[model samples]
Target: MTEDFQEIVETFEFLDDWEDRYRHVIDMGKTMPPLDETLRVPATKVDGCASQVWIVPHIEGNGPEAVFTFQGESDAMIVRGLIAILSALFNNVTVQQVVDTDAAAAFAQLGLDQHLSAQRSNGLRAMIVRIQSLAQNKLASDS
Candidate 1:
C-alpha cells in the first residue's frame, strides 16, 4: 500500500502545473467506486469541509495487524480527489499504521498546501482528522 501511495505521489509530481494537477485530482475522484448513499448520513459527514463529505470506517481484528477500511464521498471534485487520495493511502492499512501515518506530510509531499485554497486545505485537514479519529476509536475498542 505504501508502494502504491508512492506511485500516486510520483504520478502527481509528473503533472506540469496546478491546473493540470487539479484535473488529475478530479480524474482520480471519478475513478472512485460509488459510495453507498445510506452511508452518507449526518453521522458520517465530515465537519468543516467546503463541500459535503462522508466517511464510514470498518475495522477488522485487533492490535497492529487489524485491517482498517474506509468508504467516503465528497460533492466537490477536488474534495473528492482528496478523499480518493486518502482512501488509497489508508484503506487496508493496520489500525496502528493508520494512526501512525502522517497525513499532513502526505499532503505536503503532493504539494497540496501550496496549490489548494485555504478553505480546501481546511477541508483536507478535517478529512484527515475524521479518519484518524475513526482509527483511534478502533484502537480504543480493541484495548
Candidate 2:
C-alpha cells in the first residue's frame, strides 16, 4: 500500500508537464480494482462526487489497533483511482488512526491537488468524508 503511494509520487515526478500528468493520472485510474456490484446501495453511496460512488467499511477486532477494511467503487476511472489511493492508505488502520489521520494532508503530500482536476479533487474529498464518517460511527458504536 505504501508502495502504491510511492509509485504515484514517482509517476507524478516523472511527468514533464500537466498534459503528461493527466495521462499518468488516467493510467493510475486504470489500475484500480473493480468494485463489487452488490455493495452499491444508497446508504453506501458517497455524495458530492460527480460520478456514482459507493463505499463500504468494516472494522475487525477491538481497541485502537483494530483493522478497518474498506471497499469502494466509482463510475469514473479517475474516481476509482482516488478510491484505490484512499483504500491503500486507510484500510487496515485502527479506528483511532482513522480519526486522527489527515487525509487531505496525505493527498497534498502526494501533490494530488496540483495533478488532478477540480471535479476529481471534490470526489476525493467526498470519499475521505465517507471514510472518516464510517470510522467515527464505528468508534461511537465500539464505545
Candidate 3:
C-alpha cells in the first residue's frame, strides 16, 4: 500500500539518527509474524543474500486484480527487518500494482540505500526481483 509506505516514511522522519532508524526497523521485524517452518525450503530461499532468507508467496483473486501476498524469514536480524519491510510494502496488493510498485523509491525514501552495505543492498534487490517474478507468473497464469 502506498499509504503504508508513506506512513513508514513519516514515522522514520521523526527519528533523530540512522541508529534509531535501524532499531526501529529491527522492531518492525519483531512485529512480523513468524514464518512457518514448512516453507523454509531451498526453492523458497533467496540467493545472493549473505544471510539465509526464505520467501513464500500466495496469490489471491483472479485476473488483473489478483493480490500477491508473501511470508518470509531470515537468519540475520537486519535481513529479517528488510524482509518485513518488503512484505508490508508489497503484500495484499493487485498483481499489476505489485509489478508497478517502486520498492527502490520506498527504500530511498527510508534512506535504506544509504545505510545498507553493498551486499545487503544486492540482497534487497534480489528480494524485490523475486516478488516481481511471482506477480508476473500469476499474471501469465491468469491470462
User: For residues 29-85, could you state the per-residue lDDT of candidate 3 as single tens digits?
Assistant: 888888889888999999888899998998889887997888999988888988888
lDDT of 1 at 31: 92
lDDT of 3 at 108: 94
Q: Candidate 1 residues 1-143, lDDT tens each?
A: 47767878999889878888889889999998878887889999999997999998988898778999888898888888888899888998899999999988887888887988899989999998999898888888778
Pairs of residues at least 3 apart in sequence or in different chains that clash in candidate 3: none
Worst 10 residues of 2 by lDDT: 1-10
Query: CA lDDT of 107 in candidate 1?
Result: 78
Superposed by TM-score, candidate 2 places the C-alpha of residue 107 at a distance from the truth, in angstroms, of: 1.0
How many backbone clashes are present in model 2? 0
Q: Candidate 1: worst 10 consecutive residues by lDDT? A: 1-10
RMSD of each: 1.1, 2.1, 1.1
Which residue runs does candidate 1 get wrong by more than 4 Å? none
Off by over 4 Å in 3: none
